[model samples]
Target: MPSESFVASRLTSGNRLFPTVVEVTDSAVIRRRRTLFSRSEESIHLQRIASVRIETGLIWSDLIIESTGGSDPITSHGHHKADAVRIRDLVTAAQTAHLPAATEAGPSRACPFCAETIKLTARVCRFCNREV
Candidate 1:
């Protein structure tokens, strides 16, 4: 899936020069911060994200994305409340989409046409080269 970006509002403190940008994608969340002399970025994979915390103010919101590895959390503030919420939602949706499928259905099954053992999730038979 395509990535969605949220930028902190410049009106808030510490963002008057270069606002922070947060990007959420199917595989990871990235935060980009810029300064007069340098730029920095932080990223956490979807599977490694532990939680998302949002602190809402009257107008803007703060976002904190914690990692399961006990590393530093990715944080950005001064974003619109709606954008902050959307970022959390997108992270949740992406994590769910990235989860591995259950194997309770069985690992392998016989292909009806080829009578060959194949993965349960396979749509085509490798032995017969036909759709199953």
Candidate 2:
């Protein structure tokens, strides 16, 4: 069996260091298996993988796997629990950075008499014809 450190290194490497085969079942579950240099084989179950992209190199194998599921497989430097925590943190960070913030930012304006909300750029309220 390959050492845990070796497995982790292969996984975290941005470039494809292993040949990965992803199997997607009818139920949308994904099973990812990677064989590195024919010496190490690691498998990870990713709940739902919508798509996969693989880049093969002459000398090194590069694989990138994306999942549409709620979370990704956890990789840790320590125990399994630590790996879970690390994965959760990584997922959370990715989600936080993935979302686009609202383009418009300003105080919300409501007509005093009509109780209608109006956009900051709006000259008149669509719901109630109130000049801002």
Candidate 3:
């Protein structure tokens, strides 16, 4: 997937001088904040992301991206509501794209009735179409 960048509105507080920019890519979500002297960046891998929260006000929205590792979340304010939602959607899509591989890593066992290998979580035997 192509990387997308969303910049917070300049009119909002703390963004009048330098707005925050968030970039969403296939693998990660990155937030970049710039000041006069120093620039700061934070990122969370798509697979590690636990949640994406959006607080929408009348004009702008605040976005929070949390990870499963219990670290500080990446937050960006002054974004348009639509932009915030798009960010969340992109993250969800990226995470779900990797879900099947993650799920397929679980253990498998032989189906007693059919003597065929099947996922441990499966209740039916694939080879004989019988309840395992």
Candidate 4:
């Protein structure tokens, strides 16, 4: 079985279509070239498929194909999708955490000239103080 991450990477890395020479069986070899076309006009060549196999199982049959192309594109897409999901979850969790509650428990500081709240470590009021 192909790795999900590897397959996902290959599927989305801007190379939607892959082309290659395929050896379907021990004696039959065919060159398969797949191109992903945007608007059916602009086409981007993906990879050169070199081989294909039909594996029969107890329930169903599966087609296993292979290509002799660089793994960069596939790996890139997989990494990108995975990274995006991770980042999104991290942001959501951080937002839901007790941010204000933690800050409220610390010492309170205020600007002498204005009623604006400030940080204790601040040398001067960020909103109004001109000199330290």
Q: Against the true structure, what is each candidate's TM-score?
A: 0.75, 0.29, 0.76, 0.28
**Candidate 2 lDDT by residue in tens digits, 1-132:** 111221222444432465233222222222233444344333333333333343433433333445565455322221233333333344344444555875765666777657777666778777877666
- Which candidate, 3 or 4, would have the higher TM-score against the true structure? 3
Q: Each candidate's root-mean-square deviation in Å?
A: 10.3, 13.9, 6.3, 17.4
Whole-model lDDT per candidate: 0.93, 0.40, 0.94, 0.36
* Model 2 weakest 10-residue run by lDDT: 1-10
**Candidate 2 global CA lDDT score:** 0.40
Q: List candidate 2 segments past 4 Å from native.
A: 1-31, 34-79, 95-104, 112-117, 122-132
Q: Candidate 4 — what's its lDDT?
A: 0.36
Clashes of 4: 14
- Best to worst by TM-score, what's the order? 3, 1, 2, 4
lDDT score at residue 50, model 2, on the 0-100 scale: 36
Which candidate ranks first by TM-score, i.e. highest? Answer: 3
**Winner by lDDT:** 3
Instruction: Please provide, for model 3 over 8-82, each residue's C-alpha lDDT reduced to its tens digit, 9 standing for 90 to 100.
Output: 999999998899999999999999999999999999999999999999999999999999999999999999999
List candidate 4 stretches off by more than 4 Å: 1-6, 9-75, 78-105
Clashing pairs in 3: none
